[model samples]
Target chain A: MEIKQIAEELVSLVREGKNKEAKEKFYSADIISIEGNGDKVEGIAAVYEKSNAWMSQIAEVHSASVTDPLVAADHFAIGIKMDITYKNGYRAVLDEIGVYDVNDGKIVAEQFFFKS
Target chain B: MEIKQIAEELVSLVREGKNKEAKEKFYSADIISIEGNGDKVEGIAAVYEKSNAWMSQIAEVHSASVTDPLVAADHFAIGIKMDITYKNGYRAVLDEIGVYDVNDGKIVAEQFFFKS
Candidate 1:
C-alpha cells in the first residue's frame, strides 16, 4: 500500500474506534511508539499493552475526532482530539498531532506531539 | 496576544522567510526546540545558532511552503515543505510537521516530526 492509502485506512479505522484493528493491519512488528512526554515503547505487543492499559482507565468517551492527514513523502500527520472522563473522575480534553512513518508499505513509527 | 493571533503572525513571518523575526516576536526566551532526529536544544540563542548553521549550508532554496496551522488548545501543528540544494552539492526535498506549544502568548516549545 502507498503512504496515502495506509494513512487513509489508519485514520478511518481510528475514527471508527477500531484502533486495535488498525494497529494489527498496518503497524510493523517492531514499530516504535513515542508519547508527547517522551515515553517510548518498542514493538507491536508493547504498544498494544500500553494502549490497552490506557483504555481500561477511561470511564467514558464523550467525543473524539481524527483530522485528515497531511501527507508528505513517506510521512504523514494528523490532528486528534478527544474528550473523556477517566475512571478516577478526571475529565480532560486531549488535543495532539500524531506523526507516522511508513516504510515498505508498513507503518514503522508513530510519535505524538502535544502540550502536557 | 491570543493563541490565534500568535499563530497567525508566526505563520505569516515564516511564509515571508522572516524566521528570525518570527522567533524574536513570538518565541519565549527559553524556548525548547527539538528536531525530527531527536536533537533537542534549549534556549532561543542556541536554537538560533543551530538554525543559522543549517541555513549557511544551503546553497539554494528551490521552493518552500508552510501549511495553514491546525490549532487546538494552546497547541498548533503545521506542515512544512522545502526543496533545496546544499553547498556540498547534495539536493533534497524536506518535509516535516512542526508542532508548537504556546504559553502566555509566547511559543515555549516546538518539535519537528520527519523521517531521516
Candidate 2:
C-alpha cells in the first residue's frame, strides 16, 4: 500500500474505534513508539502493552476525534483529541499530534507530541 | 493575531531562514521546546541558544523546505526537510515534523518528531 493509503486506512480504523485492528494491520513488528513524555517502547508487543496500560486508566471517554492525515513523503501526521474521565476521577481533554514514518508499506516508527 | 495567522507567519519566516525573527514575533517568553531526542528547553533565550548551537554545527545547508501548515484548533504542524553537510564532513537529509501550540495568539510550546 502507498503511504497515503496506509495513512487514510489507519485514520479510518481509528475513527471507527478499531485502534488495535489498525495497529495489527499497519504497524511493523519492530516498530518504535515514542510517547510525548519521552518514553520509548520497541516492537509491536511493547506498544500494545503501553497502550493497554493507558486504556485501563480511562473510566469513560466522552468524546474523541482525529484530523485527516497531513502526508509528506514517507511521513504523516494527524491531530488527535479525546475528552475523558480517568479512573481516579480526573477529567481533561487530551490533544496531541501523532507522527508516523512508513517504510515498505508498514509504519516503522511513531511519535506523539503534546503539552506535558 | 489568530492561531492560523501566527502559524502561517511563522512558516513563512522559517522558509526564508528568518527563524529568529519568527521566534521573536510569535513565540511566548516562556515558550517550551522539546526535541525529538527527548531534550527539553524552556524560554525564548534557551530556544535561541539551542538553535544557534545546532546551526553552529552545520557546515552548509544544501537545501531546505518547509511544508504548508496543518492547522487544528490551537495547534498547527509543519513538515521540515533539509539536506545539509556538517562541519565533520558528514552529510544527510533531516526530516522532521514540528508541532506547535498557540495560546493567546502566541506560541507557547513546540515539539519536534523525527527518527533519532
Clashing pairs in 2: none
User: Which regions in candidate 2 have their CA more than 4 angstroms from the true location?
Assistant: A1-5, A15-18, A28-66, A71-75, A80-96, A101-116
Local accuracy of candidate 2 as per-residue lDDT tens digits, B1-116 = 88788888999999999988999899899999999777999999999999999999999999999988877667889989999999999998988888898889899999887766
lDDT of 1 at A17: 96
Q: Write model 2 residue lDDT over A1-116, tens digit each, in one string.
A: 99889999999999999999999999999999988788999999999999999999999999999988887677899989999999999998988888898989999999887766
Estimate, for each residue in A1-116, the C-alpha lDDT of model 1 and write its tens digit: 89999999999999999998999999999999999888999999999999999999999999999999878778888889999999999999998888898999999999887777
Q: Which ten residues in a row are the worst by lDDT in model 1 chain B? A: B69-78
- In model 1, what is the error at residue B6, expressed in angstroms? 2.3
Candidate that would win on DockQ: 1
Give each model's whole-structure lDDT. Answer: 0.90, 0.90
Top-scoring candidate (TM-score):
1
Docking class of 2: acceptable
